[model samples]
Target: MIRAAKCSFCGGDVEPGTGIMFVKRDGTVLHFCSSKCRRSMLELKRKPVKVKWARKTREQAEAKVRRR
Candidate 1:
């Protein structure tokens, strides 16, 4: 049975139209409808994301101490 695929980037239904598949080390797979989306997805994986709690500054730490 042939199942329809979906695009990870734009959430569009993929119709076997020359798409690219990405596989991670943990066996996770992501499919993209075009090369453009695939390239962008790879770039996103290369960048590091900062945690919200880790973004606190020195002043914020001092204020928390004063409140306590």
Candidate 2:
């Protein structure tokens, strides 16, 4: 998949003839049109996003008992 030269955050068109890249751990390549956008994305990646309700949680869970 070829990512266009656009800001991944803002989706703004990236200036042609001006871009940078880096190799990820998975051997995937990243293309950034500008330093600012790249920095923003890097910062975002550093933080762990919280996922709600991956399965069942106490907030929306119930207790059940079983007997033989």
Candidate 3:
């Protein structure tokens, strides 16, 4: 079953079979919708919340849902 992936850095939808999947030495799996997302995450080491252009992360969205 193909499932849509969420961008690890931008919280954007990554269509099945598209985007980049990065695996860290510690077994951390990160999905990036675009090279821009990948660069922001690994190279730049920027936080989604701290970046004004970044979208709200899945955790942030879930937190809002749980709070209500």
Best by TM-score: 3
TM-score against truth, every candidate: 0.55, 0.42, 0.79
For residues 1-68, could you state the per-residue lDDT of candidate 2 as single tens digits? 55356444334565656677766899976666666556756755521122232112222333332221
lDDT of 2 at 56: 22
Question: Candidate 3's residue-wise lDDT over 1-68, tens digit each?
Answer: 89998988888899998999999999999999999989998999888977766677556766899999
- Sort by lDDT, top down from the best: 3, 1, 2
Question: How far is 12's C-alpha from truth in model 1 (Å)?
Answer: 1.3
lDDT of 3 at 62: 69
The TM-score of candidate 2 is 0.42
Lowest lDDT sum, 10 consecutive residues, model 3, at 52-61
Q: What is the C-alpha lDDT of each candidate?
A: 0.58, 0.49, 0.88
The digit string of per-residue lDDT tens for model 1 on 1-68 reads 65667765554566765577788899988877776556655775421122222212344556889999
